[model samples]
Target: MRVAVLGGGLQGCCVALALAERGIDAAIFDRNDQLLSRAAVANEGKIHLGYMYANDVSYSTARMMMQGALAFAPFFARHLGSSQDSLSISRPAAYVVHRDSQRSPGQVSQYLKTVHGLIREASGRRGDAYFGRDLTTAPRMWSEAEREAEFDPQIALAAFDTAEVAIDPAALAGAVRSRIEADPRIDVRLQHQVTSVDDADGFDVVLQARCGILRERFDHVVNALWDGRFAINETRGLRPDRPWLHRLKYGVSFRLPRGTSLPPSATFVSGPFGEVVSYADGLTYLTWYPVCLQGISTDVTPPEWPTYPAEPLRSDLLQGTLKAMAQFVPCLRGLDPGGLEEVTVKGGVIVAWGETDIYDPRSELHRRFEIGVTSRGRFHSVDPGKLTMAPYFAEVCAGRILQDIVR
Candidate 1:
């Protein structure tokens, strides 16, 4: 039996690869000529564990993100068909900075305790977390006393190294795409948009390819179409009574002034409404979400598929991003957010399913990288939260799909 995988993003590519690994014939359909150009490629190049999810304790495995982080290394090695001891790793130790208004030294210490729990969750009696002693690159803290002098006197409370790595997105996607494309069982269809899917024997999907429209039937259909998945399903009369939702979150990646001295290891300054992630490629500083005042739209309850212009990091967006950056990094003050060179703005809608209860960081809109099968049982949606964990989600979701097909 053949399976049709929709959307050629990270999830779609991974699902196809996983299915092929089990010897199940699969096809991937996507509209982007450069399949990894969208949200999958354009993102803060983080290999996140629980540092990002420390605030999100509502879930059983609030710090369980380390579970996914652990799985990625081997899976990524296999995806690249590489035998190297490690993949492309940029360890710019992560930081979770706090503002004086919201956090105190005691609170910062408590926060570090939570991170320690995450490390324990990630590795048992191990020095490191993700890459040997490398993953847990020794989480360190600059006490409240240390922070007071370096930061804007009033705003800075405390800061710490979160032991996170940054992987090159384009490289990761290219590796996965190249490796998966070489497999004969996995048919890779680029520049092909899945226009619609309907009930036939299993599912009949219409595609608008570069040449013309094409239709195919499959035993099962998997939708890894990020923000657009819901709309595509809605067209098929598959509405969500209990549905997973998607929203657009924008990010602005910019370069700091030359000779700006920063911590040798510290990266991604994090506070309540301020975040700055230094990416692997270009070493560009990306700020967004709760930090940037205008990252989320006024009302994108159910965000539309982002119709971003060919080159659009609107002036207002850039302005807001710089403001957020200064809130965290005092050194970034007065750096012009303009004069963007090459790729600058990166990000799109992140998905959330089920009931999200927290506000802001742990809020309903928080990002997750997990997979799901629809109630219909035949279709699986790649509802992801983070870039680092997409492969793990695909592995689990692929197993579920294969089990059904073989039975």
Candidate 2:
């Protein structure tokens, strides 16, 4: 069977890999000249376990995230042909509660305990399936003294040690690219911008390439574009019923200064705070929500910006993120001016359902459970929700497409 998978981001790569494993030929169409060049590579690759969604009081977001987190390592490792233990995992993150957080430390703590309970319950007999580590252990909250030592006492109220870690997106992209290049069943059509997908006997995928327009028919089509997935979905008459949002956020990464003691991988939660991830490969990533988030669009597709922003804006984001992060983690103050190396600031588009910013308690962005594959016949549109859910949803999409063949 022939399949066309739009967008060469993590979701599209996973979908193509899954189908190739099943002996199905698939083509990945992406505007970028390389796979995983956009959101897949630009952001902090947090493999979230739902600790960030304390605003979703119903715990539905926690449940959905737990399901995906469990399957992330195994599914990704299998497709990448690598050992789970070999993945370059960041250090265990400390969830620091900001002083001006939307949810109080007590409330966020309760939510963390509840989410951990769900994770333990979900693991069942699949011990150590999550990144090859036991997830049954309860989360540990730091003492007042412990929190005060690492964080500014005025900005950080509490901190909890959780097993949540992020995979290095560069390493992941390289691995996936190697696997895709070696596979004969997957054809990657780079620099091909898919303008639309029309439903006929199957699906006609119209592509606007540098040369000219090209059309191709495929038995199945997967809309997985990180930047323009919604726009393509609308062309296929698969408009999202609920309100949606497309946000642009930036991630700043640099090498830690020589002789600098690395700060713990940390995420400020329950508000519009930020995260600092120090990966094992010596790449430290920082993102301050208030400073690094650039724009928002209610339109079907977000405005296009260069992956690497220009000089002054890029420098501004770097300095601003460092300043904002140092407010909570004081160690970052030293690395801002001239202590760091190879600093880069890049932005990626985040698509989710919400009209309000994250600071609002009533915002729909707090709950991200309303995402996955929505299919009409053989055409599939995927919203992986978060980067953590990509591999899990890819498997689901492949299974659904296979089932369509039987009917």
Candidate 3:
């Protein structure tokens, strides 16, 4: 049978590829003329290894996520590149930063031990393990990191090197596109947006385009539109969940000064939302780990919310990013920091909510990607399954939906 997959971001691409592999007819309908626009392109490309969540989550949850992260490298290898240019993993793994919060040094030490233990366990034998440290490298590397991407010594409580990585979003989109297009059975419609869906024998789908409205019927419709969840549910005559609101964020891209040398490939600072990643091209810089998470309290949600609007490059956002970045990377301080250049910003959407209007990062609610179904199970909408977790998530989603139908 044929199925229509809505949206063409990473999760959508993964789902479509999975369906085509299953010998089922799958078509991708996307609004943008190109693939992986919106949040996909803006993704700072961190393939988490559970280090970021060790202090905030249970050992079991962290362990599961770590194993899940390992899937990304194999997946990328199958789809990513040639010898000349490739999507290799990030260097220097990551740094779990600490702040002047309630968590003490003793507590921080225990958490690092736990994270390192998991890394050793994943290696297949019980053995001793260690982590990398030193915020300041040598006179050379330290000078470079300071001049290029600043790393503050005090912000880090403990530093650990785990089996995590980062990949180029552009390369990823290309690989998926190549694989999907190679399948003669699949049809990919560009500039076509799935407007809505309804129930008949299966489901009637509506499409909106510059050419006008078009409609079709499909046995199953997978709503992989990241931010379109609320509207799609209404298509099935369901009341929208007021609690499911989109939280806005941003990805700031910038460059370091010329005649400068960078210390490492990627560095994730823990204290404040800070990250400095050297892209595959090996020269550009991006602030990872948006420090804005703390501004959002546990109890604040809409109607009484203090969240940023869904706007990009606004004065407030630009200033906010600059201020946040400087906090963890002091080298970035200057009226006209000649060291940093070409600052650009992109808007991002987090398809999540603070339960009852209270946002808690530690809660399972914000930790995992969301997959939901209509009351009758005829229609489904997926949250943004991060790049690292997309492959596994796609398999689970596809198997659950198609397994019953095949039987």
Tens-digit per-residue lDDT, 1-407, candidate 2: 89999999999999998898877899999998899998888879899899999999999999999889998988876776544446688988999898888999899899999999999898898777788776877889999999988899788889999999998887788888888999999999999999999877788999999999999999999999876988898897777788888889998999887777788898998889889998765779999988988989999878996678998898899888888788778777777555568887887888889889887879999999998998887888899988899989999999998877776
Estimate, for each residue in 264-308, the C-alpha lDDT of model 1 and write its tens digit. Answer: 233333333545555444455455545332333222134444433
Ranking of models by TM-score: 2, 1, 3
Q: What is the C-alpha RMSD of each candidate to the true structure, in Å?
A: 4.1, 1.3, 6.5
The segments of candidate 3 whose C-alpha lies over 4 angstroms from its true place after superposition are 60-64, 80-85, 116-150, 237-242, 255-259, 263-272, 288-323, 330-344, 356-366, 369-378
Q: What is the Cα-based TM-score of model 1? A: 0.81
TM-score: which candidate is best?
Answer: 2
Positional deviation of residue 32's Cα in model 3 after best superposition, in angstroms: 1.8
- Worst 10-residue lDDT window for candidate 2 reads 77-86
Total clashing pairs for each candidate: 7, 0, 2
What digit string (tens of lDDT, one per residue) describes model 3 on residues 1-407? Answer: 77888888887887776676677787888988877776676666776655555345466545645555655555444444352145444454545444553345455446656766665566343121111222122112133333334455566444444444566665566666777777786688888877788777788888888899988888778787776655676667665444454555555555556544543443443233546555444434445344333223221122222222344334445566557656655544552432345655554555554352222334444344333333346466665445556665666667766785788
Q: What TM-scores do the predictions have?
A: 0.81, 0.97, 0.75
- lDDT for position 253 in model 2: 90
